[model samples]
Target: MIRVAIDAMGGDLGPRIAFQATQKILAAFADVEVRFYFDPQHFTVPEGASSNRFTSVSCSEHVASTESVDRALFKRCDATIFRALTDLAGEQVDVVVTFGNTAAMVALTRYIVGLLRPKLYPALIREMRPAPLKCLVDLGANVHCPADMLTGFALLGSAYLEARSDDAANVALLNVGVETSKGSSVIKDCYQMLSARSWPAFSGFAEGFELFDGGKNVIVCDGMVGNAVLKASEGLFAFLLSQLSQHSMDTTAVEKLVRAENRHGACLVGVKGNLVKGHGRSDEKAMVGAIEYGIDIARTNLSKKIEQKLIQQGVL
Candidate 1:
């Protein structure tokens, strides 16, 4: 059985979305069990929802989305994210899924669960839209990354795709233009670093429009640019839906195609165990999607595969 620990006290919607998502996950997957960490003073389980597969643990503290990473790590050591990660480190849980403070979650994961390599940091990797087989790295983990960090993200992203598909990943660096001379010095340095490797197929640089064109299997970028592109795509999806509705067009197909791409949670790679981070403002549907995504990661043993890949590539 796969055990998933969730930070119920996190996210903008509070514990309600967590509870609702838990119920949905419980009904959907019999092989998966859920454990929620929440403050007893703030949340209570709905009547008659208890089961052997679903359990709740009482936590006394919560981490706000605006909480600084340093404050969360030092002052709010007993927060829900901290408790969940501690359990993860202790091997009590197979995976952790939370819609909490992104910075706090990444920082606490590194401090608690530990990283595969001390010099390498964790990154958020998610499958890109219109092409679920392709992925983007550094969704929002580290906003300012150096050239070596970007190269590390590329390695992590390639390993992630390989873990899921059991095939070598074709990687590309995201830039303003496809030419190597278009981006900043950091991008150029990363390109040179990746070009030196032969394991993961490097396909030069890629423009933003190439994300959905199926030109590459993995696109690498820093957290700032990745987060900006992610938010922009979400806004564009919403605008498209609204326009379609006004035109009295059938929006079911459009929603079905874009919802999975935009709403699924991102996997925090380079960490010791499986950790999935949902958006801070995630609704019940998005929360459920994140939990399911965590289950997939645990079942596949993704973290171990990534570590092995890194070692094979001499990046460790």
Candidate 2:
């Protein structure tokens, strides 16, 4: 059975959404088990969440979305996210899913679970739409990455896609212009480093407009830029949908498509264990989607595959 550990109190909606999601997942998948970590003093699990496959652990503290990583590490060691990562490190669960502070989660994961490649840091990768196979790496995990870490993101993103499919991933650096000389010095250095690699298909720099063109399987960038791109895309989607409604166009089909596209959560790649981070404002449906994403990653043995790839490529 696949075991999933959840930080029930991580998101903005509190533990209610997590409990509801757990109930839905338990009802749908018979072979899955879930362990929820939350503060019993602040919230209570729903009656319907009781199942042999379900377990609850009490955690008195939780890191807020605005909490700094250092403060969380030193002050709130008993937070739900920390406890969940501890369980994951101890082999109590196959994977961890949280919608808490991204910075805190990244820090705590490195502190508790450690990295697969000691020299490399973890990056958040998420599949994008219009081209479902396309993915963007470093979605707000590391705000400032040097050239080496940027190349590492490429490796992590490529290996992640390769694990899910038979084809070799086509990687690209996200930049303002497609021209090789266009980005900052750091990006140019990353481009040079990636160009030296012979395994994965390294397409040259990709402009933001090329994201949905289905040309590159993986787009690499620093966390700050990637996070901005993601938020802009989401905002644009919402604005366009609203405009379509104002025009008296039927938006039902578009809404369905958006929902389907938004199902998968971001994966914190390069870590020793699987950790999926959902949006902080996730509702029950999105929370369930994140858990399902974690289950899929767990089943794929993604971390093991990444390790093998790193060894074969001599990345470490």
The model with the greatest TM-score is 1
Cα-based RMSD of candidate 1: 1.6
What residue runs in model 2 are displaced by over 4 Å at the alpha carbon? 71-77, 130-132
Q: Taking the tens digit of each residue's C-alpha lDDT, what string does model 1 give over 16-58?
A: 7899899899999999888889887888877666688988877
lDDT of 2 by residue, 1-316 (tens): 9999999877898888888898898888898999999888779876666578998888888887897666538556678998889989998899999998998899889888989877688999988852357789999999989999999999999888887677679999999888876989999999999898896789989988877776688999999999999989988988999999999999999898888777457999898899999998888988989999999889876778887887787775
Worst 10 residues of 1 by lDDT: 68-77
The TM-score that candidate 2 achieves is: 0.95
> Each model's TM-score, in the order given?
0.95, 0.95
